[model samples]
Target: MAEVILFYFLMAFILIAALIAVETTDLLSAVICVGAIGFGCALFFLFLRAPDIAITQIVVEVLALVILIRVTISRNATFVTGDREFFASVVSVVILMMIFLMAVQVLNSLPAFGDAVFAEVTDSASKTYISQGMEKTGAANIVSAVILDFRAYDTLGEATVLFTSVIGAAVILRKRPRKLPEEPQI
Candidate 1:
């Protein structure tokens, strides 16, 4: 069918673009290749009926491209470290692959394997919340009941910590106010 043909065509284009992105000497062209591959991936996800994920990915890809180009062109950005750091990168990648494989294996062994965990959680939460704790919590939203009744302080602490860390990071990373250059002496 035409759909299958289009899928394969996009896949082939993606693979070629990814290869060019990885192996090209020109950074700008590599960025273009990566963007093209990301666009193809978003299109593929849209075709597969994952509109939410596709939209999120496309937005992220655009933001990433903008940020990367901005950083690459910014002041103090001549930051060229030689490719001699390849060995450290190889080791980091190997360790990351091991961690990824372990995570996938753990996920595969979960009770909710091949099933949506949210549906199960919300289903059970509704039953338990309404049956036992409705009078105690007096909340109509069963999902919120389960979360708030059991983990109210935990949730509050998490939000507090997240807000604190974000504010701290912003304060630390914000550029100091620019000073005017001194006038040249006569």
Candidate 2:
């Protein structure tokens, strides 16, 4: 009961933060609101017994915050949009909501949480991972084994992309020294 309540509270908090992030004109405040959403998502992952995902979420959130700060340091503080832009945003949001509804309908047709979709398959992928992952990879934690061993290349690629983005942001924001004009000697 308490867990359910906590989950709902976190969900509400996430929704509120997201709405604030979307509506706020101040870029820094919006970024901070986005951080709140990230923190809530990490908490949700922790509550779901996915500490690995939670840790990743926290790290990614911090990195994103740093990048956002760097990117916004030289820019104007507030966002300004025209009426046409606002109209386009409204249309985009309506389309997104329709897509979200469709996704929810599709997901509702699938198996419920913790319920196996394939009962006939004696060893589900998760079951196999739990049973074989540790023995194969010599890692005690299943999540670590899966990430470090099974999906190492994918993780490496993600890290590379994140690194590239950080470097790109730094390059874009770097200030070049102005060339001083030389005066003619008498």
Candidate 3:
């Protein structure tokens, strides 16, 4: 009951932050609101008992916030509200409502909380990881065994992707060197 209440409160907080991010004219304020939304999502993942996902979310959110804040601080803030802005806002709200409805429907179809749906499946990968992970990988922690030993290649690929993305963002955000004019010979 407390978990459910916390979940809804977090959801509301995330929704308000998202709306503030979209509606704010100040670039820095918008970026801060977006960071709030990301952190709220991390909290939601934690509430769901996914500590790994929550940690990843926090790392990604921090990186994103740093980049966004840097860009927002470096750039000149501008707002251009016109007649179409109202129309666009309405359309965006309608689309978001549709997506929310679809997500709710999907959530409704899922099994109840704390239900062990995978228990019946004897040959599932989760079962294998939970049962023989320590013996096979010689790791004390099951998560470490699965990530470092069982799915090492997959983890490596994910790390490579994250590293590449960070490099790409740095390259894109970096300031270009000013070109020097050549002197003409007499």
For TM-score, the strongest prediction is 2
Segments in model 1 whose C-alpha atoms lie over 4 Å from true places? 74-172, 177-186
Per model, state how many residue pairs clash.
0, 0, 0
lDDT of 2 by residue, 77-182 (tens): 4564533578897998899999999999999998866566765478777787888998999999998898789889988998899899889877877899557989
Q: Give a tens-digit lDDT track for model 1, residues 1-186.
A: 677788888899999999998777667667778889999999988986667669878998998788667655544534434465788989988999999999999987776533545556755754555687767788765546666876688879978998998899788778996589999999
Error of 3 at 60 (Å): 3.0
Q: Which whole-number lDDT from 0 to 100 does residue 27 have in model 3?
A: 78
Error of 3 at 117 (Å): 4.5
Candidate 1 vs 3: which has more lDDT: 3
Minimum summed lDDT over a 10-residue window in model 1 is located at 73-82
Clashing pairs in 2: none
RMSD to the native, candidate 2?
5.2
C-alpha-based local distance difference test score of model 2: 0.87
Q: Per-model C-alpha lDDT, please? A: 0.77, 0.87, 0.87
Measured against the true structure, the TM-scores of the candidates, in listed sequence, are 0.46, 0.77, 0.74
> Looking at model 2, how many pairs of residues clash?
0
Query: Clash pairs of candidate 3?
Result: none
Using TM-score as the yardstick, the better of models 1 and 3 is 3
| Model 1, C-alpha of 51: deviation from truth (Å) | 1.9
